[model samples]
Target chain A: MAALVIAEHNNQTLNEQTAKTVTAAALVSTPVHVLVAGENCKAVAEAAAKIAGVEKVLLADNALYARMLAENMETLILSVAEKYDAILAPASTSGKNYLPRVAAKLDVPQISEILKVVSADTFERPIYAGNAIQTVQSPAGKKIITVRTTGFKAAAEGGSAVIENLAATADAGLSKFDSEALSKSERPELTSAKIVISGGRGLGSAENFKLIDKIADRLHAAVGASRAAVDAGYVPNDYQVGQTGKIVAPNLYLAVGISGAIQHLAGMKDSKVIAAINKDEESPIFQVADFGLAADLFQALPELDQELAKRGY
Target chain B: MGSDNSMKVLVPVKRVVDFNVKVRVKSDQSGIDLANVKMSMNPFDEIAVEEAVRLKEKGKVKEIVAISIGPAQAAETIRTALAMGADRGILVKTDGEVEPLVVAKILKAICEAEKPDLVFTGKQAIDDDSNQTGQMLAALLGWGQGTFAHSLELTDASAKVAREIDGGLQTVELKLPAVVTTDLRLNEPRYASLPNIMKAKKKPLEEKTPADYGVDATPRLKVLKVSEPPKRGPGIKVKSVSELLDKLKEAGAI
Candidate 1:
């Protein structure tokens, strides 16, 4: 019995999180199999099969899996629970939705957002939004966990695993999908972007957010916002980056005018190079930033963009 | 579950370190120091309580019940919920700590007995930040759930909620006996007036233990250690954008 990593995808392409989850699963066992559960998702299954260290790929194409209703996903996972020693998923929104249902149906406690794999049974996860780390050991009948994809490297694309179709399961009829309103954007997804440029309350008004966008456009970076900026209506709620918002670990994170609150710091502190440009030198963001510039973002955005443009960015 | 005042809402709250206080790791790194530290209701749970109270004020809800599972002092958190207009409180007393899985199990047991039409809780407790109880509870009961809800509209038999997801807002509809967890923008909690505080003192608070509900409060995971996060090195004060760009290039982060 090997570990099963549930792949997160949109039926067309595989999400990067699935590879990171595979990296974690490979740590637990050698024969890692990925489950792609969606409607007309053979492309995603093929993508999962090519990931390094994946020995097998299980494909479950059914209309019940459309939009991934938790009940339907749970039913599908439980049908094959007896074959795997461990069940894991990337701690994405969809993963959080269905993994708990799988764990509940299995009567086993789930380990959420593990940061380190100490052993087959022991793992480490951040509690209180990375304020403290708690190492835990779960010796249940089966291991059910969610890997924090940011903590692990992604598996490479070289393996030639076999893709097998799985039998469908019955629907529980417990829940139904209504409709969803997603933000349509041409910019890269925030979680997987390499460079993230964020603005804060110091930007002043919603119109002032254009300054953050200008730098992002020049650098081809994704734009994010501090909680204060979103709370002040400088941007939409989806732009927020904090403990309660999206956590991004990028190669370069540029903070403009954001006096980094502890909650805000928790989200982007994992970046490789953190750069901050704020008028206040005492901003906590400066403490974590790799490069600190004491200046007004209103004046600095254009200056930085000009510098980047001159460099043929 | 209905649009009228006969609907009953069950709201669960937790006692956590107050949001204003900075938590410090113990010298030995055993855990965070709670001695002499300020503890209050989780802010997100306060939003949950406020949302429930607003429904009551609009004549959409008839009763609101609050519950807390922790040491005896957790009654204070439930008292705050009562002061916010919850009709009653339940204190599930325990000497040791309980994880989210057991908390959900105990809550499910209580829900079975109370038979409330709806359940509301914070998306995650600021202390653990696990964000599991609501989803786990809904799973245990085999019910629908809408988590991280921003705006909620109630129909005659179902609820449509605009949830704050990863990249944008997602609207979901769930049938009766559903679980909903509150996010930051759901609603602002009101100040507990002096009269309500006094009234909360006389509110009926039932006391029970996990054993009473056939739930074992034993921990499943053994905590090997607790340590403070690694601190980043002191940043270089770059004089100009060129210096910043050069540093980023040297670090291979550009």
Candidate 2:
């Protein structure tokens, strides 16, 4: 049986995580089909059809699915659930919101944030804030899973798959959309950036967080914050990177003034190059960091920014 | 908003390994070592209890019932909720590892019997972090779900919840009798006072089992192994910022 992967996207652009999820879906079963459910999202559907491993694209364009609300998305997924044996989605905020509803309605257990596709029925996931890796086997039936995008390589765009139009499911009328205050930043998004620089409570006041910001801007990287830094109001909740916050696996992750708690390390330990600058030499972050610099961030940040400038960065 | 309105709320809490304690994997790769670890109410569930209590304080709610689906010790977690101002408690006692789907099924049965106007649960427990129960419960009940809510405003007919999304906040309005999952920044949970803790002991706590609800709490997923994650290699400490930059350059990280 084929696997169905729900595509993650805004109405305009396809999120790269959808491509990564397609990779995981293919590993679960062959002939993966991508489902794009949104309003006026034909371009996103077209993009999903080009993903290498996808065999088909299921497009359900309607006003009810514009925001991909849980009630509406669950109804839509279940309408076509009979054709697939495995259902998969990226563990994004939207995916987390709706996938379980489909899983419960289908009477199956949903695995959240799997890191590896061990087999058709077995998978690996992190628990206890990524302190442990657990391998689990799903029962024989429909498999429901949310893929952690950082754990898999993205399926390259080359193949041309057929697009099939799916009818919209009836709206549950259980919820209504009001408004959104999305953070508008000129910098790259934290989860998708190749380079990320994060600050912690050791940065002191919110004003001092500018030091981390300047370095991030110079490096053309996204800005992140530890849970303490966010809870201390040094940054907004969106900037937080931890177990409860965003999980990022960038190429280079430089944590400044951040004493890595296990929860904080859970979000970024998968980065290719891990570095830290903390005054405390015995911080737990150093255990996972490939490069550790024990220096006061206030003095070191400015010097580092200047040195980068000297190098024409 | 009237005084006679039956605005009852239900909050579900879980007992988890304390957040401050570092969790260690067992030597046999069976699971986490829980032999001597201190356990506390899951932090996000504490936030849910606090939110429900705040609603009751504002006269928007009349009664609060806290529930847990775990061992008898989970009643201690419910006691913490009662001390935080919940009116009663229910313990769905099970000694095994009950996954989110089974917990949702059990909660669905309780909702049918209790008929709460609102159901609040933590977004995810820190132990398993499956993040599926609330949404699954909502599905079984055919109710709206506001997941990851940081701010919530309730009315007679609906609730306006500002959720913490990936990039920022998104507000949605869900009809009454809906399920809402609490996230961080919803509100700061208050410490239980000595008097309140003493008062909570007398609160009604009814114990039941998954069998009582006619829900099979059997394990659907089999655990193959539980092992420690791969450890990074030991790193050298750089004495100066210049050396740090040089090392990063050599590592092709700059």
Candidate 3:
């Protein structure tokens, strides 16, 4: 038996996380199958089939799975849970919401946000908000896991696999979709972005945070914020990159006007290159940064923007 | 508007290291040193407590029951919740760290008896950072869930919750008796005053063991090893933005 990866997609397009999850699946065994459960997800199923390591695609396109609601997903996964040795999903909101449910229903222990796969049974994850790393062995028959999308390289798209239709499961009838207020952005998704520019409470106001966007736009980077910035109404909750928010490991992560809180460090400390700009020279962010510039962001913004523009960035 | 003063709210709090303290991994790499560490209520749990108290004060809720699962010292965490106006607390005593699944099972047992109309918990504990307890409990109880909820408006039959989803907010209407996990921006928790601290001493705190709930505290996953993350080399200070850009370019960070 092989790992069955739950594909993350929004009816129209598959999320990059599905490819990353496919990579995690390879760590377990070959003959990986991507399960695409959504309404009109044939294209997403085809995309899943193209992921290099995937041997097959399980498509359960149904109205019940339209929103990836836990109620719907829990049933869909259990309907096919018996065929696989392990069930894996990207640690996205939808994944987290349903994986645990599926695990509980299957009476198997579930691991959250695994950073490394030591073997099919052993894995490493961060505890104490990434301050301590623990290698754990699941002493169970079935393995249920949520793979941290940023931890693994995405499985390249170049294969053709057979797509099979799965019989739909009954809706649990316990929950309903009311509405969604998704944050719309032209920039890249924060988790997958190569570069991220994050701001904090020091930005002062929502309007002042535009300085972050201007610089991020110049580099085609995703804009992120600390919990303080989100709580201060400077940005939406999804913009938060920290222990309580999205964890990111972008190629270049620049912190502007943000003091590195331990929780915040837990999210982006894995970035390949870290840079910090703050008025306070003693900020903890500088401690983790590979490059530190102790300067007022207000004074530095214009100068940095000008330099980047001059460089045609 | 919903029925005022009839609903019971349940808030689960976790005792964790103070948010300000920098944790150090132990020499043997078993885990972080906890001896002499100053611990407090998980910050997001504090938000949950505050939200519950606000609902009570607004007459939308009649009772707020706080629950903590850990060692006896966790009672202190519950005291803090009571001081924050949780009305009462129940400390589910255990000696060792219980994984999220077992913790959820214990809570499920208690919820079966308490029959709270609502359940609130921190989205994730800063300690384990597992982010699974509430979701698991919701799964166990077959309750509607709104994880990472930023705001919640209550009604008679359901709660309209605005959750922080990637790139935006997703508002869901969870029917009554739902599990709502709090995020950072839910609400600012007020500091418990000196007087409240005194009053909280008299507040009832019931102690129970996992056995009382017929649940096992045994962990499902075995810890193979524990270690500190790789340390980043000390950063070099750049004198100016132009110099910083030059350094970034040289490092191929741009």
TM-score of chain A of 1: 0.96
Off by over 4 Å in 1: B1-3
Report the lDDT tens digits of candidate 2 across residue range A1-313: 8999999999889999999999999988889999999999999999999999899999999999998899999999999999999999999999999999999999999999999999889999999889899999999999999999999999999979999999998889999999999989899989899999999999998999899889988889999999999999999999999999999999899999999988899999999999999999999999888889998998999999999999888
Off by over 4 Å in 3: none
The Cα error of candidate 3 at residue B220, in Å, is 1.7
Residue B127 lDDT in candidate 1: 91
- The stretch of ten residues in a row with the least summed lDDT in candidate 1 chain B is B164-173
List candidate 2 stretches off by more than 4 Å: B1-5
DockQ, candidate no. 2? 0.88
- What is the iRMS for every candidate structure? 1.4, 0.8, 1.3
Q: Model 3 Cα displacement at A235 (Å)?
A: 1.9
Predicted model with the maximum TM-score: 2
Per-model CA lDDT versus the true structure: 0.88, 0.93, 0.89
- The window of 10 residues in a row where model 2 chain B has the poorest summed lDDT is B1-10
Model 2 lDDT per residue over B1-254, tens place: 22434698889899999999989999999899999899999999999999999888887898999999999899999999999899999999998799999999999999999999899999999999999999999999999999999899888889999999997999999998899999999999999999999999999999999999999998989998999999888888888888888988999987
